[model samples]
Target: MEITFLGTGAATALPLPFCNCPLCCKARTSGGKDIRKRSSMAVNDDLLVDLGPDTASAAYLYGFPLEQVQYCLQTHSHSDHFDPAHLITRLPEYASAGVVPMKVCGSSLTLKHMSEGVFREDEGTDMLSPEGMQKLSIQIHQAFPYSTFSAGRYRITTLPCGHDPGDGSMVYCIQDGNSTLLYATDTTSFSQEIWDFLISYEFHFTAVVMDHTYGSGINGEGHLNQDQFIEQLRIMRKNGIAGEQTLVFATHISHEGNSTHSDMEREHAAHGYAPAYDGLSIRI
Candidate 1:
């Protein structure tokens, strides 16, 4: 499996537009990996996680074949994650040519919120309706927690994210051939139920891209800080879910207490995981 991080920043992205804090100022001075877009990822050029506001721009900048994307797994309907403006462009009225039909999978509430976003953008385009979905060249598949389903050649299992309870946010376990990935973001620590499910399912991951929304010692509700992130990794390792070869990466970063990308990489490298930056790609 080929994984590409289109963007790796948290909800507000790195370097708030109007703020000039130390981290933000340093990010401005140190361009390269410090520059980040909203959180999003692409798998093997075919599947996308989170159609965020910067998805198109990030893909274009990184030379990813965005046109080949056939499936999208939405974690939630947060504006930073699911931008209806991008989805609206698939409508024939936009003169978008040769658009591939997209299959979007998410919790029912998430899907409903996304549809409402589309309605807000296009003025009454109800993406929940069959006619509306056909016009947009998209299919909405409601994914329930703990259920596995197939999308094209990949098998996906939905896992609840203890983030936005109202939106029914979810993480994902995606498998393609012999490679398996755990895409966990916009989440706090896993619940006991989730741990039991993972144990019972005998899931061993090839790679793990997990949430690190806050930096060390920083408290952020509905997100993981460095300490919490490491604890989760410890549990995964103890349970045999993440073996020695598992490529672990921290994503959905923010400028809260987080330092520059290089600094973070150096700090986290000893913890069995590294911070992912925009355009970073790996093969498992």
Candidate 2:
């Protein structure tokens, strides 16, 4: 599977407007691969996880066929993770596609709020009907652990993401014929329940792109810092859940992560996993 990290910053973005912190300043001056945006990604050119506010711009900038994407699985209703207002443009009025409408799935809050929030606006979404859902192959399934959804060539199993009240988030154990990938983010630490679920599973994980919103000794509730990521990596390696060949990447970064993305890179390299950046394409 080819996994591409379209954008890797948190909602506010590195160099968040007006915050003259060290991280933001370094991001402003740094010119190479260090430029990052909000978190969102494309898998094997078909499946997508999260539709952050950055999607439209990233789609244009990174050269992914945004409208032609197969499945869009939302993790939660967080505006940073998913901004349906931005996604609604692809529905009917903004971009006219000759093919099927986009498939969107998530928890109830994600789907319902997106529908009420975006499609109902200025009648910009008219072609979207129940038939469009069928046409695009968009099926809303409850994001409970171990429940699998088979759509053509991909087999998607939803796992729990640690965050929020009862609203919920998810991790996808996505598999094709031979390889499997775990798309997990927006989780602070890998919760014990989720850890147990992965331990019970059989496939070798090719890659894992996770939230590294914090860096070093900083702490937070719903997101993982660099130190936390290192801890989790150790756990995975020790438990045989992952190995040397299994690539680990940290993403969903904030400008407050450190002085620069290099700081994050150095720290992550010390732990052995690279920090995921925008437009990074990895094949597994």
Candidate 3:
């Protein structure tokens, strides 16, 4: 299985549009990996994990085959992670000739919001009818926590996350053949119930992309810092969900985190953690 990180920064991105903080300034001056877009990833060119506002530009820049993505898994309703406006372009009129419909799975709220957006224009007028969406050939599935679903060669299970108090968030564990990947982001430490659910599963993950909204310090709830992330990884190890061979990566970074890519790599190398950058690709 191959995983491609389309974007790695948090909602504000690495260099906030109008900020002059040290990290932001450095990212602005130093190009390359220092620059990042909103968080999103594609697996094996078939499954997309998020549809951030930057998806289109990032896909063009990184040469992502957006037409090949068959499934889009939304973690939550957060604007940074779910961008319905961009997804509307997938309609047959705007997409490449003969592009297939993309199956999208998320919580009920997420799907509802996306459907509402696709059916109406920004001004709230009726833009597209059900027949139009049918012609466009889009499918929306509501995913339930702890339930399993299949998308292509992947068997996916959803885990509730500690983000958003109302409906919470969904974290995905996708297994294809011999390899498994845990995509966990926009979340803080797991709850005991979620921890138990994870421990019940015996498969080891090939790679895990964790939440890193806060780099080294805890700025708020519903997000993990570097220290908290390591602690959670330790628990996963104890539960046999991860081991020495599991490739660990951190994403959804903020500019205010105050750590550069090289600095985070050096600091986290001992723990087998790598700070993910936009366009980073891994094969498992």
lDDT of each: 0.93, 0.72, 0.81
| lDDT of candidate model 3 versus the reference | 0.81
- Residue-level lDDT tens digits of model 3 in 193-230: 98888777675888989988886765767888888888
* Candidate with better TM-score, 2 vs 3: 3
Once fitted onto the true fold, the runs of candidate 2 whose alpha carbons sit more than 4 angstroms away are 119-139
> Which digits, one per residue and each the tens of the lDDT, describe model 1 over residues 182-274?
999999999999999999999999999999999999999999999999999999999999999999999999999889988898899999899
Question: Model 1: runs farther than 4 Å from truth?
Answer: none
Question: lDDT score of model 1?
Answer: 0.93
**Order of candidate numbers by TM-score, starting with the best:** 1, 3, 2
What's the C-alpha lDDT at position 4 in model 2? 81
**What pairs collide in candidate 1?**
none
